[model samples]
Target: MYDFLLSDEARVLRSEVRDFVKTIPRQLLLDMDADRVQFPKEFLAEAGKRNLMGCRYPREWGGRGLDWVSTVMVMEEIGTLGYIMACTFGVGAELVCDAIIRHGTDAQKEKYVKPLLKGEIFAAECLTEPRGGSDFFGTTTTAEDKGDHYVINGQKRFIVGGEGADYFLVYAKTDPHAKAHKSLTCFIVDRSEGVIVDYIYGLMGCRGGGAARIVFKDAKVPKENIVGSLHGGYAVFNTMMIPERLGTAAMTIGAARPALEVATGYTTRRKAFGREIAKYQGVSFQVAEAAMLLDACRSMAYTTSRAVDAGVPENEIRRLVSESKKFITESCQKVVHNSMQVMGGIGYTNVFPVERIFRDVRLASIWTGTNEVMSLIIASEWYRKYMDDRASGITRDCENDAVEAFAEGEKIYE
Candidate 1:
């Protein structure tokens, strides 16, 4: 059905992920939400055995050697399971393993990336701190250089997979005197004695994957464990943002889609005033609008994924990636809310999955770089492009003939 935008191989991969998701029992999902299910290590092992964990990484690293679009497809399917499960999968493969593959030495890849993909060990990215959320450069975590090793001392909160991860891709300031962006360094920190999992958050939703606050008190890491060059962590961070934002957008589609399906089916059979609710223009219109919004979100996600696969310029990718994250996640929140409205009071109860979905979708706009942050990036990049065009003496206007004919003073903004 999505053949116009996705190739046959992509469609097949989507089916494979969808099939795997079906094997996960509904009770297991409930257990996860209730915090009865601990780590889901067995589930990760199953995914690894199926070659579905890190589909986008190189073949030697235990991935399927797929493109970004394929990774999106896998995430989209896993997302249908629920936010927590999808996030667990992403933290290991997309966030942590990808970072290692891109910046780690051969030894690091052999030790961490391979096991990470095979699900023998799990990994987490410890970026956000208690003091700063979006201000990544303002990290209070410090990695002091010793003669033979670096001693990391800091706390990272809201770290997904924090409690269960065998290792962490930790970022800390190595050169305090340097500028915020240049002072930082990335490390492969094992969950050794000095590393502590402080508290597992009692979240409003998306629970049971062990999101927690992690503390590193004089955690000693070898010099060889440094990811990329010391004090060059900003480049690694920038590279990571593309996958983080784009993957969030893709997963939001999966979360919203099931809710929409349920609502659509309900409206067809659900009666109001002695007739099926679908007969009413009010409910029908809402269903149509929600469907349209989901379609638009999916299109944007796929387009951005394809752009990444094609290796588009970094700046252009940044603009589109931010736009995709901001737009898709916000649209998903709307779609799920509308779905609840269609189902009425029953939707609010645990009887329907829409209520859970409603809560889960709320976090999509807030995490992986908040939608507000995404707006800042999108507008800044747009302005930069506009100024660059002006500097180059390019007089390109809107591609509409009527708009082109309008006098400069007649245009509203002009």
Candidate 2:
């Protein structure tokens, strides 16, 4: 039954990850949620030792040399721990290591990627700034090019791993006078080089791993640290978004699973009117809906990951990825909320894990590009594809079939 979605190898990797997750003490998980355990470097180091840090990266870079589908399996299992742990793993393995693998110079890869995959150092992507939220190209951070170095000055807010990162993949404006997409550049900046962790947020959920505001004031970055070509950060940004968004979608599957399980167990055992609560349509129906939604999201997430592995065109990937992230995250919220509802008031308190999962799942829709932004991208990409096909005289027979069934006079819009 699972053959189409997962191979034997992927299933084995999933078991391995779950085994590792099982070793994490319940107190440690609680400590993380309570904000007492910041960074969780020890946990990450342990994952590194197990060679679970970067399953999809090349073997030479300290990874297992697996495919994107394998990485999704790992993410899903780690996601059961909570959003904080899942995101911390993603920051180094998916976002930072991926950027280096794609665009970093040999020197940069040697210096950063290997250590990153080994969990020797953490990294953060500094893109969102104080003035702009999702207006990535509207970044006011400046990287003034000198003969041998670039002087960077600006602040990035809500940077995951900001407080503990050893290095940052930062995007800054290199040519303010140029078009928004053409004016930007990406750089690898060491945290020791005059970068400041201005503030660590007091988050409502998804705490731990140190999300913070970071300031780079007169930081001198070597010209060699640039990723890809000068003033070509836009391409790099787009490239990273594919994994960033998709990884979040996969992680949400794991996060929501625990909530569903808790609710299922409680409703089955807990009695109401001398029978199990699960016997009632009111409670049982929600469980059924949550199960269906979770399966759909999981299938879409894996399908998108496989497409990524196959190296589909970026624009096509963008549409499917945006759809997956938006739908899965939103669906996860519903699943968790429904789980809480099925358990009644007990699910809302710390007495159960459902409450914590509910809070943690809220951020998935908002981060890695807001769901609204994902919708915008999905619609824009669809329109662009439709127009391109029309301009190229390539008619889609399925679309034409619907038009053919309607009388010409009755086709009101036309």
Candidate 3:
């Protein structure tokens, strides 16, 4: 299915990424885990030289001019290393760079997007507030116009890379009375302003990149720093949401792959009741089930990426994105859970990374819009198509006899 979904060039790109990740020192990953720090500069520089940081951007701006499939390939590789690397180098770049490349003027693109693609500048997305999570419609951050500049004031909570980011891709309300989706606006706010960052929140996992809260107390931002248009936050968000879902799905599946391998190895070697754990059908079946689910999700993610690359219609793309996000993230959560069960005692302990993988994958189902939100999107889309078709007067009128017979046999109910 991957071969059918991904082009030959995309497959080659995937192989290249896998080979690069294979040579990354295990100690490097271990140190990253131990130190709980952002990605080392050396790694980022190497990735930039290899064109992995900007794989999806056009070639005119120091990118490789590849499509989203190539981006997913790199994301999977980074996810294999750890969550911080994936967020900083893969997810962060996609979210920030995509917006700038699509909407920024030439000057904004040169200053922010190009350098970011080359890894000269790192960007962090600041969308969630102290009162906002999945519901980003109620952000209290306000960008007040002051002639040649705008003054931003509010606090952002749980912002990824809030403490150390060179540039912040922030969302602030510019028109409170506009429609709910369009009332806010996005900006490329530099850290030199009067922005105060505080590192206070810690989580069960993904601690390396410094997820902190930022307060902009009358922070001055140039009027030119606004991304897209004033009161156009929805457009900015809509442009990147699909890519965010697709990239996140790929990352989760990649992180789960190692857990699957560890569980398989443990079951084959660990002795229980004078036989290997693999001999127990109960344990073996769990591993087999997990493998299938992971494979299914992987296929869906790659397919969605390819569809996006082919420029599928908006309705179709939305359907695929919602399905891919829900399927891949939810399956990752289940697969990691089964892996822990297969590892038995060691999985629950810090001796293994399975527990960490488990916690990290759970965040996927919640991030980039929760799985529950995905369901709503899917249902709404399906209902719209159904109603549209019905309104078009396209209905089968001669199935009454068949419907009556089926109802008589099965007692169907609505």
Candidate 4:
């Protein structure tokens, strides 16, 4: 399928990228791996210098202006190197840049987005609070209008890139009196405004990018710093979800491919009782199944990428994006788990990267809206379409019409 799907031009691009990534010395990656506790600002700058950080940004904004496919290629290449580099940079490129492009005003874009494109600073999405994880809109963070500025006060927990980021795109209640989703607003809050980041966390995996808990004590952002319209934070989020899902799918594919390759290589070399472990039917079969699933999931992700590139209708894009992300992440988890199973003890050890892959890919199901969340979106869309079609008389119940006839036919047979 990969062969059939990729055009000659795409093949040429993929080959060029693959060749380039192979040249990255393993020691450089190792050095990056060692510095995974917080964002290596210097390291990100170097990546920006190489034009890696801003791969998908518009050309007008200092990005390479590459399409999503190209972006996916870069993610896969970085992931093949290691998960840490891929994920750390992904927070900036995929999530932060995504929001900026969608919701940022020209001024906001000029100040934050440009600097981020150059990798001059890291960025974080401050959505989760101490009380909410997936329930992001249930935020307790409050931002009040104070003439020329807004004063923000609240605690945000589990903020990715928060500890080291120079900018935070914060979601807060702009109108407490407004109902449900309408109360929230997004602000491009600079970190310098008396904003405090505390409770920095180390992770089981993805330690390359810092995730922190932050507290804002009457932090002030200018009135012009508001992203999107007043009480329109939800739209900003919706705008990012499609690209976020696609980008996340690419990352998962990258993580899974390498883990599987490591397992396959290990099984072929490591021996048990005389022959290589890969010679065993048990090992071989597991590898076969995992390879098949991972490839299928990868295809789904690529399909979504193409859909995005072609600019499919928004609803269709959303459906495909969700489907691609849900399948890829779910499959990657199973694939990584199988890779671990095949490697047995070695897989569990820190020496092998499979354990890290397992941890990293597991979060994919939780973040970018959980797999459960994806299913709900897909199912709701499906039901909405079905209901709309029924109301418009586009579909008829053949089963209902044939019910009495079938019963009569059964009587004749009897």
Candidate 5:
């Protein structure tokens, strides 16, 4: 369905990524899902060795310098391994590198971005705090200026790779007196000194991705380690949304794909009422619906990737990405749910991978900013853009298209 969206080069890159995906050990997946592993270090290491990590980064930074479309392709292929593996890949390749590339100084990039894409070290985005996840501006984490460096103090919870990551892209309030959007700064906080992983949370799914709470009490970050300018974290954040939200949207589609495939194959063999279950509308319709949902989801993700690549306006990009994330993730849930129902009771068991896929995709709607938040962005941006365009005569005033267009007395206002 997405063939036309890719260039020939992207197709080649996708093949390389698929080859790397094939090399992943099934045992690693099983171990992670069972919580026997905290992080899969070898997974990223092997991907780096194969030069298959971070397709969109510069070749000097150990990337192919591919476009966002290529990265989405990379995401979907890795996504089949399950949520944790794909997310682990994304945290380093997309999330962390995005902030660095967009805002970090050259020295900082050489020090962090190169090693990260090389898979020599792991990275994490430490954003969500004990205060809240969606309300990022409500962060209580603070970094106080102290001449040569700053002392960062606060706690970040539910951080993927919190335990295994060698460094973190941290957001902290740098100016108490300033407005929320201007009060914060982005910093590269190493996992040394005052940085501490105080607790590890047992997650419902996407296990073994090093989900934990990090406590930073007087963690000294050098003035040089700050990303972008002082009090500019919000800009870094708004830009990084392209990777965080869209990456999640694309991955969920790949993650849930197996469920549809597995269920479809089963319907052909699983018998009911002495005939193939697939012959029944109850069964076939579910498969049809799941397939349709995935195709639709793919369209949104691909379109949004193109928009970001085309240099669409920031607000427009925000609306597009939020819609992609919300719609694709929600579709993933229904696809998994439909697949489970189609396969009957056996689908709920570990005998098939449908159950695991179900567990993983269930968190998609909740993470990378919830679908509810996406709705807020969608509505807010739509209204702002539409009104602005209408006032400027860029949009046709279709309000007068009705037959009762001149019935002003009927158009009462309070």
Candidate 6:
């Protein structure tokens, strides 16, 4: 349905990504879920080989230079395979690469971006700490400058692809006395001396993507590897968030759409009192609601992507992007739940992919900054914009038009 929105290049690239996704072995997903495969390096290898890893970047850096809409389209196809699969693709293809593309020097791109997109190496961004996550600037990880190099020492909690990563884009406090926004710095730390990855086990969902805790015990990283200017991590972080939140929202939309389809298929064939279960309003209505949610979320994701591509103002983009992530992921959760509900007992079983998606979808609201955080970002930006408009007299003052316009004492504030 959305194919008409794609340019010729985008349509062709979408086909290429689909072709790559189609070749993935079913056993890979099964093994990954079962924890038989900690990480699927070969998956990225093939995607990179096909030149589909980072399609949004420039051709000079190995990407096809596709726009955000096209990337979202490709992610939708990748998402059908599974959330873990889509996330594995997004980690390097979008999230990790975004910082380099937006801030890193050409040499950094040539060294890291090319091989990563080509699937020769894999990368992960480390941010969340053992102490906290939502308060991102509260990270305890410290990088002490040693003139020739920076010695990084800290722990990152629950990193996806931790075990499989060839390198990490780590953020650590560089200026202990500086303000929160200017205290930290970003760096490209190769997996060399003093980097330890402890693969986590018994996860509720999102297994086999090499989820682990990363420890930097005085890890040696050269000064040359610093991602942006000294004490400039805040800028890098804000820049990278566009792809992180938006791509997750996009992939999640991909993940839930097929789950509803699968349940719809089951309801049509499964028997009820006397006929197909789908004939029952109880079952069909769930399907309808799920479809509506998927459509709404998809529309939001597309509009947000276009906004990002169109270079919408930073604050407005932040508001829309956060809103997209929050609304879309929550909607996806509902869609998956409704799908399972419509399918009855079987949907709860591994017999259907809905159960798996249901488990994975739980993280939709949690990771990439929880939906609560998204709400905070959204409301904050919205209020900020509204107040700016009010201050500038750009919007009509409706407060004065109230029936009790002269009753100023009635509108009391504590």
Ten residues in sequence with the least summed lDDT for candidate 2: 1-10
TM-score of 4: 0.89
Encode model 2's per-residue lDDT on 4-57: one tens digit a residue.
666776777778888999998898889878888777787887888788877887
- TM-scores vs. true structure, each candidate: 0.95, 0.95, 0.91, 0.89, 0.98, 0.97
Residue range 1-414, candidate 4, lDDT tens digits: 465555555466566556656766665654444543465566567666655665667877767666777777667766775565666677776787788887787777788877787778788888778786668678889999999999999998777677788888888998888786899998888888679987354566665566788899999999888888889999998888876678778878887888899999999999999999999999999999999988887778777888888988878778888888889888888889989999999799879878777877777777767888788878887887788888898787555676475565364524
- lDDT at 303, model 2: 91
Model 2 stretches with alpha carbons more than 4 Å out: 1-4, 389-414
What is every candidate's alpha-carbon RMSD to the true fold?
2.5, 2.1, 2.8, 3.8, 1.2, 1.3
Q: Where does model 4 exceed 4 Å of error? A: 1-36, 392-414
Instruction: Point out the worst 10-residue segment of candidate 6 by lDDT.
Output: 404-413
Candidate 3 residues 1-414, lDDT tens each? 455655676677777777777767766766655554544556665666566676778778777777887777778777887656676675446888888888888898899877777767677788877785778888899999999999999988777666667888889999888888888989989987588888644566666555778899999999899999988888998888877788888888888888888899989999989999988999999999999998898778878888998999888788889999899888887888999998998999878888877766767887678888899888988888777877887876444557465555476567
List clashing residue pairs in candidate 5: none
lDDT of 6 by residue, 1-414 (tens): 777668999988878877887799989989999999999999989888888878889999999888999888888889988888888889887988889988999999999999999999999889889888888899899999999999999999788888899999999999989999999999999998899998889988888888889999999999999988999999999988888899999999988888999998999899977899999998899889999888888889889989989999999999999999999999999999999998878889999888999998788788889999999999899899998999999889988997788885887779
Clash total of candidate 4: 0
lDDT rank order? 5, 6, 2, 1, 3, 4
Best lDDT goes to which candidate? 5
Model 5 lDDT per residue over 134-212, tens place: 9989999999999999999999988987778999999999998999999999999999989988537567788888888
State which candidate, 1 or 3, has the greater TM-score. Answer: 1
Clashing pairs in 2: none
The worst-scoring run of ten residues by lDDT in candidate 1 lies at: 397-406
Q: How does model 1 fare in lDDT?
A: 0.88
